[model samples]
Target: MRYFICALFFVVSAAHAQNTTALPEGAASPKATLKDISWMQGHWSGEAFGGITEEIWGPPSGGSMMFSFKLVSDGQVGFYELGHIRELDNTLVYELKHFHGDLKGWEEKDEVQSFKLVKVDGKRVYFEGFTFEKVSNDEINIYAQIGDEDGSAEEVTFNFKKE
Candidate 1:
Protein backbone atom coordinates (compact mmCIF):
# COMPACT_ATOMS: atom_id res chain seq x y z
CA MET A 1 0.00 0.00 0.00
CA ARG A 2 1.16 3.55 -0.77
CA TYR A 3 1.19 4.41 2.90
CA PHE A 4 4.04 2.02 3.57
CA ILE A 5 5.77 1.80 0.24
CA CYS A 6 8.77 3.92 1.10
CA ALA A 7 9.52 2.34 4.45
CA LEU A 8 8.64 -1.16 3.29
CA PHE A 9 11.23 -1.10 0.56
CA PHE A 10 13.93 0.00 2.94
CA VAL A 11 13.12 -2.49 5.68
CA VAL A 12 11.84 -5.63 3.97
CA SER A 13 15.29 -6.60 2.79
CA ALA A 14 16.21 -7.16 6.40
CA ALA A 15 13.18 -9.32 7.12
CA HIS A 16 14.97 -12.55 6.40
CA ALA A 17 18.05 -11.49 8.29
CA GLN A 18 16.08 -10.80 11.44
CA ASN A 19 13.97 -13.93 10.99
CA THR A 20 16.75 -16.30 10.05
CA THR A 21 15.46 -19.69 11.08
CA ALA A 22 13.57 -21.53 8.41
CA LEU A 23 10.40 -23.51 8.97
CA PRO A 24 10.78 -26.87 10.68
CA GLU A 25 11.92 -29.55 8.30
CA GLY A 26 9.15 -31.40 6.41
CA ALA A 27 6.55 -28.78 7.17
CA ALA A 28 3.87 -28.06 4.58
CA SER A 29 4.64 -25.12 2.33
CA PRO A 30 2.34 -22.13 2.23
CA LYS A 31 1.06 -23.01 -1.23
CA ALA A 32 -0.08 -26.38 -0.01
CA THR A 33 -1.26 -25.05 3.33
CA LEU A 34 -2.89 -21.82 2.28
CA LYS A 35 -5.90 -23.41 0.64
CA ASP A 36 -7.69 -22.21 3.75
CA ILE A 37 -7.02 -18.64 2.76
CA SER A 38 -9.29 -18.93 -0.22
CA TRP A 39 -11.58 -16.69 1.78
CA MET A 40 -9.26 -13.89 0.68
CA GLN A 41 -10.67 -14.01 -2.79
CA GLY A 42 -13.07 -11.34 -4.04
CA HIS A 43 -12.93 -7.58 -3.53
CA TRP A 44 -12.10 -5.94 -0.22
CA SER A 45 -12.05 -2.25 0.62
CA GLY A 46 -11.00 -0.05 3.50
CA GLU A 47 -9.97 3.44 4.52
CA ALA A 48 -6.49 4.64 5.44
CA PHE A 49 -4.29 7.69 5.09
CA GLY A 50 -7.42 9.68 4.40
CA GLY A 51 -8.07 7.64 1.27
CA ILE A 52 -9.93 4.58 0.10
CA THR A 53 -7.88 1.51 -0.66
CA GLU A 54 -9.19 -1.57 -2.38
CA GLU A 55 -7.71 -4.97 -2.86
CA ILE A 56 -8.85 -7.70 -5.25
CA TRP A 57 -7.40 -11.17 -5.14
CA GLY A 58 -7.97 -14.09 -7.42
CA PRO A 59 -8.43 -17.55 -6.01
CA PRO A 60 -5.30 -19.59 -5.54
CA SER A 61 -4.33 -21.39 -8.72
CA GLY A 62 -1.22 -23.03 -10.04
CA GLY A 63 0.41 -22.55 -6.66
CA SER A 64 -0.14 -18.81 -6.66
CA MET A 65 -2.56 -16.15 -5.49
CA MET A 66 -2.57 -13.03 -7.62
CA PHE A 67 -3.83 -9.65 -6.50
CA SER A 68 -4.09 -5.98 -7.27
CA PHE A 69 -4.48 -2.89 -5.08
CA LYS A 70 -5.70 0.58 -5.79
CA LEU A 71 -5.64 3.73 -3.66
CA VAL A 72 -8.02 6.59 -4.25
CA SER A 73 -8.32 9.94 -2.54
CA ASP A 74 -10.60 12.84 -3.10
CA GLY A 75 -12.01 11.25 -6.25
CA GLN A 76 -8.53 10.83 -7.69
CA VAL A 77 -6.28 7.82 -7.86
CA GLY A 78 -3.11 7.82 -5.79
CA PHE A 79 -1.40 4.63 -6.89
CA TYR A 80 -1.85 1.00 -7.85
CA GLU A 81 0.00 -2.28 -7.49
CA LEU A 82 0.06 -5.86 -8.67
CA GLY A 83 1.19 -8.70 -6.48
CA HIS A 84 1.38 -12.44 -6.16
CA ILE A 85 2.00 -15.04 -3.52
CA ARG A 86 3.90 -17.83 -5.19
CA GLU A 87 5.35 -21.12 -4.09
CA LEU A 88 9.08 -21.25 -4.48
CA ASP A 89 11.74 -23.56 -3.04
CA ASN A 90 9.26 -25.22 -0.73
CA THR A 91 8.23 -21.80 0.57
CA LEU A 92 5.90 -18.98 -0.33
CA VAL A 93 7.03 -15.56 -1.45
CA TYR A 94 5.09 -12.33 -1.63
CA GLU A 95 6.23 -10.25 -4.58
CA LEU A 96 4.82 -7.01 -5.85
CA LYS A 97 5.36 -4.10 -8.18
CA HIS A 98 3.98 -0.61 -7.95
CA PHE A 99 2.52 1.75 -10.48
CA HIS A 100 1.53 5.37 -10.79
CA GLY A 101 -2.07 6.43 -11.17
CA ASP A 102 -1.70 6.33 -14.93
CA LEU A 103 -0.27 2.82 -14.76
CA LYS A 104 3.37 3.74 -15.12
CA GLY A 105 5.45 1.04 -13.50
CA TRP A 106 7.65 2.01 -10.56
CA GLU A 107 10.37 -0.59 -10.73
CA GLU A 108 12.13 -1.68 -13.86
CA LYS A 109 10.12 -3.93 -16.17
CA ASP A 110 11.52 -7.06 -14.54
CA GLU A 111 12.03 -6.05 -10.92
CA VAL A 112 9.76 -6.45 -7.88
CA GLN A 113 9.81 -6.32 -4.11
CA SER A 114 9.97 -9.75 -2.44
CA PHE A 115 9.07 -10.78 1.07
CA LYS A 116 9.52 -14.37 2.23
CA LEU A 117 6.89 -16.23 4.20
CA VAL A 118 7.49 -16.64 7.92
CA LYS A 119 4.41 -18.40 9.27
CA VAL A 120 0.74 -19.19 8.69
CA ASP A 121 -1.96 -20.03 11.22
CA GLY A 122 -5.65 -20.77 10.82
CA LYS A 123 -6.60 -17.27 9.72
CA ARG A 124 -3.36 -15.35 10.01
CA VAL A 125 -0.09 -15.27 8.15
CA TYR A 126 3.30 -13.75 8.79
CA PHE A 127 5.51 -12.83 5.88
CA GLU A 128 8.89 -11.21 6.30
CA GLY A 129 8.04 -8.14 8.33
CA PHE A 130 4.40 -8.28 7.41
CA THR A 131 1.39 -9.76 9.18
CA PHE A 132 -2.06 -10.59 7.90
CA GLU A 133 -4.84 -11.36 10.33
CA LYS A 134 -8.26 -12.47 9.25
CA VAL A 135 -10.79 -10.91 11.58
CA SER A 136 -13.65 -12.83 10.01
CA ASN A 137 -14.86 -14.29 6.75
CA ASP A 138 -15.37 -10.74 5.56
CA GLU A 139 -12.78 -8.81 7.49
CA ILE A 140 -8.99 -8.85 7.51
CA ASN A 141 -6.07 -6.75 8.64
CA ILE A 142 -2.64 -6.48 7.06
CA TYR A 143 0.45 -4.53 7.87
CA ALA A 144 4.18 -4.44 7.32
CA GLN A 145 6.80 -3.71 9.90
CA ILE A 146 10.17 -2.07 9.51
CA GLY A 147 12.99 -3.25 11.70
CA ASP A 148 16.21 -1.58 12.73
CA GLU A 149 19.63 -3.08 13.26
CA ASP A 150 18.94 -3.25 16.98
CA GLY A 151 16.04 -5.64 16.41
CA SER A 152 13.41 -3.04 17.15
CA ALA A 153 10.60 -2.54 14.69
CA GLU A 154 7.63 -0.31 13.98
CA GLU A 155 4.46 -1.45 12.21
CA VAL A 156 1.28 0.00 10.77
CA THR A 157 -1.90 -1.93 10.08
CA PHE A 158 -4.50 -1.74 7.36
CA ASN A 159 -8.00 -3.04 8.06
CA PHE A 160 -10.38 -4.24 5.36
CA LYS A 161 -13.76 -5.77 4.84
CA LYS A 162 -15.06 -7.90 2.00
CA GLU A 163 -17.01 -5.70 -0.38
Candidate 2:
Protein backbone atom coordinates (compact mmCIF):
# COMPACT_ATOMS: atom_id res chain seq x y z
CA MET A 1 0.00 0.00 0.00
CA ARG A 2 2.79 2.43 0.79
CA TYR A 3 4.48 1.83 -2.55
CA PHE A 4 1.21 2.23 -4.39
CA ILE A 5 0.56 5.56 -2.73
CA CYS A 6 4.05 6.79 -3.50
CA ALA A 7 3.76 5.86 -7.15
CA LEU A 8 0.40 7.52 -7.45
CA PHE A 9 1.72 10.72 -5.95
CA PHE A 10 4.65 10.80 -8.30
CA VAL A 11 2.50 10.30 -11.33
CA VAL A 12 0.12 13.06 -10.30
CA SER A 13 2.96 15.48 -9.67
CA ALA A 14 4.49 14.80 -13.04
CA ALA A 15 1.20 15.33 -14.81
CA HIS A 16 0.67 18.66 -13.07
CA ALA A 17 4.06 19.96 -14.15
CA GLN A 18 3.57 19.12 -17.80
CA ASN A 19 1.36 22.09 -18.71
CA THR A 20 3.69 24.94 -17.69
CA THR A 21 7.33 25.57 -16.95
CA ALA A 22 9.61 28.03 -15.26
CA LEU A 23 12.30 29.90 -17.14
CA PRO A 24 15.74 28.35 -16.77
CA GLU A 25 18.08 30.01 -14.32
CA GLY A 26 20.08 32.88 -15.85
CA ALA A 27 18.01 32.79 -19.03
CA ALA A 28 16.79 36.06 -20.44
CA SER A 29 13.19 36.60 -21.40
CA PRO A 30 12.20 36.49 -25.05
CA LYS A 31 11.42 39.70 -26.88
CA ALA A 32 7.71 40.49 -27.10
CA THR A 33 5.23 43.33 -26.90
CA LEU A 34 1.70 44.00 -25.78
CA LYS A 35 0.63 43.90 -29.39
CA ASP A 36 1.68 40.28 -29.55
CA ILE A 37 -1.04 39.44 -27.05
CA SER A 38 -3.67 41.94 -28.05
CA TRP A 39 -6.04 39.13 -28.90
CA MET A 40 -6.60 38.67 -25.17
CA GLN A 41 -8.39 41.98 -24.91
CA GLY A 42 -12.04 41.67 -23.84
CA HIS A 43 -14.17 40.22 -21.07
CA TRP A 44 -13.97 36.51 -20.36
CA SER A 45 -15.47 34.12 -17.83
CA GLY A 46 -14.81 30.53 -16.92
CA GLU A 47 -15.03 27.83 -14.30
CA ALA A 48 -12.04 26.59 -12.37
CA PHE A 49 -11.09 25.43 -8.88
CA GLY A 50 -14.74 24.59 -8.43
CA GLY A 51 -15.68 28.19 -8.91
CA ILE A 52 -16.65 30.78 -11.46
CA THR A 53 -13.80 32.93 -12.67
CA GLU A 54 -13.91 36.14 -14.63
CA GLU A 55 -11.28 38.26 -16.29
CA ILE A 56 -11.34 41.48 -18.18
CA TRP A 57 -8.44 42.78 -20.24
CA GLY A 58 -8.04 46.25 -21.60
CA PRO A 59 -6.60 46.82 -25.02
CA PRO A 60 -2.93 47.48 -25.36
CA SER A 61 -1.97 51.07 -24.80
CA GLY A 62 1.14 52.95 -23.82
CA GLY A 63 3.14 49.72 -24.04
CA SER A 64 0.98 47.82 -21.59
CA MET A 65 -2.24 45.88 -21.30
CA MET A 66 -4.01 45.95 -17.96
CA PHE A 67 -6.30 43.21 -16.65
CA SER A 68 -8.41 42.24 -13.68
CA PHE A 69 -9.57 38.84 -12.47
CA LYS A 70 -11.90 37.47 -9.85
CA LEU A 71 -12.96 34.10 -8.58
CA VAL A 72 -16.34 33.37 -7.08
CA SER A 73 -17.25 30.24 -5.19
CA ASP A 74 -20.60 29.32 -3.69
CA GLY A 75 -21.88 32.67 -4.92
CA GLN A 76 -19.35 34.64 -2.91
CA VAL A 77 -16.26 36.43 -4.14
CA GLY A 78 -13.20 34.39 -3.23
CA PHE A 79 -10.35 36.64 -4.39
CA TYR A 80 -9.23 39.10 -6.99
CA GLU A 81 -6.22 39.97 -9.13
CA LEU A 82 -5.03 43.08 -10.84
CA GLY A 83 -2.18 42.98 -13.28
CA HIS A 84 -0.63 44.06 -16.51
CA ILE A 85 1.62 42.83 -19.27
CA ARG A 86 4.09 45.55 -20.02
CA GLU A 87 7.05 46.19 -22.25
CA LEU A 88 10.30 46.20 -20.32
CA ASP A 89 13.86 46.23 -21.61
CA ASN A 90 12.64 45.10 -25.05
CA THR A 91 10.75 42.14 -23.60
CA LEU A 92 7.36 41.65 -21.99
CA VAL A 93 6.70 40.90 -18.36
CA TYR A 94 3.49 39.83 -16.64
CA GLU A 95 3.00 41.21 -13.13
CA LEU A 96 0.09 40.91 -10.76
CA LYS A 97 -1.06 41.40 -7.18
CA HIS A 98 -3.58 39.26 -5.40
CA PHE A 99 -6.25 40.50 -3.03
CA HIS A 100 -8.76 39.01 -0.68
CA GLY A 101 -12.45 39.38 -1.25
CA ASP A 102 -12.50 42.45 0.95
CA LEU A 103 -9.65 44.03 -1.01
CA LYS A 104 -6.85 43.14 1.39
CA GLY A 105 -3.63 42.42 -0.46
CA TRP A 106 -1.84 39.09 -0.30
CA GLU A 107 1.62 40.51 -1.03
CA GLU A 108 3.51 43.43 0.45
CA LYS A 109 2.61 46.85 -0.85
CA ASP A 110 5.62 47.13 -3.14
CA GLU A 111 5.87 43.55 -4.28
CA VAL A 112 4.20 41.64 -7.09
CA GLN A 113 4.40 38.17 -8.63
CA SER A 114 5.98 38.47 -12.06
CA PHE A 115 6.38 36.15 -15.02
CA LYS A 116 8.78 36.93 -17.83
CA LEU A 117 7.95 36.12 -21.41
CA VAL A 118 9.38 32.79 -22.54
CA LYS A 119 8.09 32.40 -26.08
CA VAL A 120 5.44 33.66 -28.47
CA ASP A 121 4.40 30.69 -30.55
CA GLY A 122 1.51 30.73 -32.96
CA LYS A 123 -1.78 31.06 -31.02
CA ARG A 124 0.04 30.77 -27.73
CA VAL A 125 2.01 33.10 -25.49
CA TYR A 126 4.20 31.30 -23.03
CA PHE A 127 5.28 33.20 -19.97
CA GLU A 128 7.51 31.81 -17.30
CA GLY A 129 5.24 29.32 -15.50
CA PHE A 130 2.16 30.48 -17.33
CA THR A 131 0.69 30.16 -20.82
CA PHE A 132 -2.10 31.78 -22.76
CA GLU A 133 -3.56 29.68 -25.59
CA LYS A 134 -6.11 31.09 -27.93
CA VAL A 135 -8.49 28.44 -29.12
CA SER A 136 -10.78 30.58 -31.21
CA ASN A 137 -12.34 34.00 -31.48
CA ASP A 138 -14.42 33.27 -28.41
CA GLU A 139 -12.51 30.65 -26.50
CA ILE A 140 -9.20 30.66 -24.67
CA ASN A 141 -7.25 28.69 -22.14
CA ILE A 142 -4.79 29.86 -19.52
CA TYR A 143 -2.43 27.43 -17.86
CA ALA A 144 -0.71 28.50 -14.66
CA GLN A 145 1.73 26.82 -12.36
CA ILE A 146 0.85 27.87 -8.83
CA GLY A 147 3.29 27.27 -6.01
CA ASP A 148 2.44 26.90 -2.37
CA GLU A 149 4.27 28.16 0.67
CA ASP A 150 5.46 24.63 1.34
CA GLY A 151 7.24 24.65 -2.07
CA SER A 152 4.84 22.28 -3.82
CA ALA A 153 3.26 23.32 -7.10
CA GLU A 154 0.25 22.46 -9.23
CA GLU A 155 -0.92 23.44 -12.66
CA VAL A 156 -4.35 24.99 -13.17
CA THR A 157 -6.20 25.50 -16.40
CA PHE A 158 -8.81 28.17 -16.89
CA ASN A 159 -10.97 27.80 -19.98
CA PHE A 160 -12.70 31.04 -20.78
CA LYS A 161 -15.47 32.01 -23.13
CA LYS A 162 -15.79 35.56 -24.30
CA GLU A 163 -18.75 37.42 -22.96
Candidate 3:
Protein backbone atom coordinates (compact mmCIF):
# COMPACT_ATOMS: atom_id res chain seq x y z
CA MET A 1 0.00 0.00 0.00
CA ARG A 2 2.82 2.41 0.85
CA TYR A 3 4.55 1.75 -2.46
CA PHE A 4 1.32 2.35 -4.38
CA ILE A 5 0.78 5.68 -2.58
CA CYS A 6 4.30 6.84 -3.48
CA ALA A 7 3.79 6.00 -7.15
CA LEU A 8 0.52 7.94 -7.22
CA PHE A 9 2.15 10.99 -5.66
CA PHE A 10 4.86 11.12 -8.31
CA VAL A 11 2.35 10.77 -11.12
CA VAL A 12 0.18 13.60 -9.85
CA SER A 13 3.12 15.91 -9.30
CA ALA A 14 4.42 15.31 -12.79
CA ALA A 15 1.07 16.18 -14.31
CA HIS A 16 0.83 19.42 -12.35
CA ALA A 17 4.38 20.43 -13.29
CA GLN A 18 3.66 20.02 -16.99
CA ASN A 19 0.72 22.43 -16.84
CA THR A 20 2.62 25.20 -14.98
CA THR A 21 5.78 25.43 -17.05
CA ALA A 22 7.48 28.83 -16.84
CA LEU A 23 7.34 31.33 -19.65
CA PRO A 24 10.19 31.33 -22.18
CA GLU A 25 13.12 33.70 -21.99
CA GLY A 26 12.13 37.35 -22.62
CA ALA A 27 8.48 36.42 -22.30
CA ALA A 28 6.54 38.48 -19.80
CA SER A 29 4.89 36.68 -16.94
CA PRO A 30 1.14 36.55 -17.01
CA LYS A 31 0.92 38.91 -14.03
CA ALA A 32 2.87 41.53 -15.96
CA THR A 33 1.07 41.04 -19.26
CA LEU A 34 -2.29 41.84 -20.90
CA LYS A 35 -2.59 44.87 -18.60
CA ASP A 36 -1.91 47.01 -21.63
CA ILE A 37 -5.19 45.90 -23.14
CA SER A 38 -7.32 46.49 -20.06
CA TRP A 39 -9.19 49.11 -22.00
CA MET A 40 -10.99 46.32 -23.86
CA GLN A 41 -13.16 45.04 -21.06
CA GLY A 42 -16.77 46.20 -21.22
CA HIS A 43 -20.03 45.87 -23.12
CA TRP A 44 -19.66 47.01 -26.72
CA SER A 45 -22.25 47.23 -29.47
CA GLY A 46 -22.23 48.13 -33.12
CA GLU A 47 -23.69 47.40 -36.54
CA ALA A 48 -22.24 44.83 -38.89
CA PHE A 49 -23.52 43.11 -42.01
CA GLY A 50 -26.93 44.66 -41.56
CA GLY A 51 -27.08 43.25 -38.08
CA ILE A 52 -26.66 44.54 -34.55
CA THR A 53 -23.46 43.08 -33.14
CA GLU A 54 -22.61 42.78 -29.49
CA GLU A 55 -19.41 41.88 -27.70
CA ILE A 56 -19.03 41.51 -23.97
CA TRP A 57 -15.66 41.23 -22.30
CA GLY A 58 -14.83 40.40 -18.71
CA PRO A 59 -11.94 41.78 -16.72
CA PRO A 60 -8.79 39.71 -16.68
CA SER A 61 -8.77 36.95 -14.11
CA GLY A 62 -6.52 34.00 -13.37
CA GLY A 63 -4.04 35.06 -15.99
CA SER A 64 -6.75 34.83 -18.63
CA MET A 65 -9.66 36.72 -20.13
CA MET A 66 -13.03 35.69 -21.53
CA PHE A 67 -15.36 37.25 -24.05
CA SER A 68 -18.49 36.51 -26.03
CA PHE A 69 -19.91 37.82 -29.29
CA LYS A 70 -23.38 37.68 -30.74
CA LEU A 71 -25.11 39.09 -33.78
CA VAL A 72 -28.82 39.72 -34.21
CA SER A 73 -30.74 40.94 -37.22
CA ASP A 74 -34.44 41.38 -37.67
CA GLY A 75 -34.94 40.01 -34.16
CA GLN A 76 -33.11 36.77 -34.89
CA VAL A 77 -29.69 35.77 -33.70
CA GLY A 78 -27.30 34.98 -36.52
CA PHE A 79 -24.51 33.33 -34.60
CA TYR A 80 -22.56 33.31 -31.38
CA GLU A 81 -18.92 32.95 -30.44
CA LEU A 82 -16.96 32.41 -27.26
CA GLY A 83 -13.33 33.34 -26.91
CA HIS A 84 -10.44 32.99 -24.51
CA ILE A 85 -7.21 34.91 -24.20
CA ARG A 86 -4.66 32.99 -22.22
CA GLU A 87 -1.02 32.09 -21.87
CA LEU A 88 -0.11 28.85 -23.63
CA ASP A 89 3.34 27.46 -24.38
CA ASN A 90 4.87 30.67 -22.99
CA THR A 91 2.91 32.86 -25.42
CA LEU A 92 -0.40 34.68 -25.40
CA VAL A 93 -2.99 33.01 -27.63
CA TYR A 94 -6.54 33.75 -28.64
CA GLU A 95 -8.82 30.74 -29.08
CA LEU A 96 -12.39 30.84 -30.27
CA LYS A 97 -15.30 28.50 -30.84
CA HIS A 98 -18.44 29.23 -32.76
CA PHE A 99 -22.02 28.13 -32.47
CA HIS A 100 -25.21 28.73 -34.35
CA GLY A 101 -28.11 30.56 -32.81
CA ASP A 102 -29.71 27.27 -31.88
CA LEU A 103 -26.48 26.38 -30.00
CA LYS A 104 -25.21 23.87 -32.56
CA GLY A 105 -21.43 24.03 -32.45
CA TRP A 106 -19.56 24.61 -35.67
CA GLU A 107 -16.22 23.11 -34.75
CA GLU A 108 -15.64 19.65 -33.41
CA LYS A 109 -15.89 19.52 -29.64
CA ASP A 110 -12.13 19.07 -29.35
CA GLU A 111 -11.15 21.70 -31.87
CA VAL A 112 -10.73 25.46 -31.66
CA GLN A 113 -9.45 28.21 -33.92
CA SER A 114 -6.16 29.32 -32.40
CA PHE A 115 -4.58 32.71 -33.05
CA LYS A 116 -1.14 33.36 -31.66
CA LEU A 117 -0.42 36.77 -30.24
CA VAL A 118 2.02 38.67 -32.42
CA LYS A 119 2.46 41.91 -30.46
CA VAL A 120 0.86 44.53 -28.29
CA ASP A 121 1.46 48.28 -28.55
CA GLY A 122 -0.21 51.45 -27.35
CA LYS A 123 -3.89 50.51 -27.33
CA ARG A 124 -3.56 47.71 -29.86
CA VAL A 125 -3.11 43.96 -29.72
CA TYR A 126 -2.21 41.91 -32.75
CA PHE A 127 -2.83 38.21 -32.99
CA GLU A 128 -1.87 36.10 -36.00
CA GLY A 129 -3.60 38.06 -38.87
CA PHE A 130 -6.12 39.65 -36.55
CA THR A 131 -5.97 42.96 -34.72
CA PHE A 132 -7.84 44.80 -32.02
CA GLU A 133 -7.31 48.54 -32.26
CA LYS A 134 -8.65 51.00 -29.77
CA VAL A 135 -9.85 53.92 -31.85
CA SER A 136 -10.96 55.97 -28.83
CA ASN A 137 -11.78 55.72 -25.17
CA ASP A 138 -15.08 54.08 -25.99
CA GLU A 139 -14.56 52.79 -29.49
CA ILE A 140 -12.59 49.90 -30.96
CA ASN A 141 -11.99 48.43 -34.38
CA ILE A 142 -11.33 44.75 -34.84
CA TYR A 143 -10.01 43.23 -38.04
CA ALA A 144 -10.11 39.49 -38.50
CA GLN A 145 -8.81 37.33 -41.30
CA ILE A 146 -10.77 34.13 -41.48
CA GLY A 147 -9.46 31.43 -43.74
CA ASP A 148 -11.81 30.15 -46.41
CA GLU A 149 -12.19 26.63 -47.74
CA ASP A 150 -10.21 27.28 -50.93
CA GLY A 151 -7.14 28.36 -48.93
CA SER A 152 -8.02 32.04 -49.22
CA ALA A 153 -8.43 34.68 -46.55
CA GLU A 154 -11.63 36.58 -45.88
CA GLU A 155 -11.60 39.86 -44.01
CA VAL A 156 -14.19 40.74 -41.41
CA THR A 157 -14.06 44.06 -39.63
CA PHE A 158 -16.03 45.45 -36.73
CA ASN A 159 -16.26 48.92 -35.20
CA PHE A 160 -17.81 48.84 -31.79
CA LYS A 161 -18.57 51.47 -29.15
CA LYS A 162 -18.97 51.01 -25.45
CA GLU A 163 -22.56 50.58 -24.33
**Candidate whose lDDT is highest:** 2
Q: Candidate 3 lDDT, tens digit per residue, 1-163?
A: 1111111121212222311122244654332265766778999999986789999988889877899999898899888888878766655777778777899877778878766566776677776556788999899988665443433434456899999
Candidate 2 residue pairs in backbone clash: none
Candidate 1, lDDT over the whole model? 0.72
Candidate 1, residue 90: how far the Cα is off, in Å: 2.2
Give one digit per residue, the lDDT tens place, for model 2 in 1-163. 1111111121224456666666667999888888789999999999976789999999999989999999898998888889999999999998888787899887778877777888898999988778898999999999877655444567778899999
Q: Please, what is the whole-model Cα lDDT of each candidate in the order they appear?
A: 0.72, 0.79, 0.67
Q: Could you give me the TM-score of model 3 versus the true structure?
A: 0.75
What's the ranking of the predictions by lDDT, best on top? Answer: 2, 1, 3
TM-score of each: 0.77, 0.88, 0.75
Worst 10 residues of 3 by lDDT: 1-10
Q: TM-score for model 2?
A: 0.88
- Worst 10-residue lDDT window, candidate 2: 1-10
Per-residue lDDT of model 1, residues 1-163, tens digit only? 4344633343544434332223444654455344645677889999876899999999989988999999899998888889988777767777888888899887888888887676777677777666677889889888756455444555656799999
Superposition-based RMSD of candidate 2 using all C-alpha atoms, in angstroms: 6.5
Report residue 138 deviation for candidate 2 (angstroms): 0.3
In candidate 2, stretches whose alpha carbon ends up further than 4 angstroms from where it belongs are 1-15
The clash count for each model shown is: 0, 0, 0
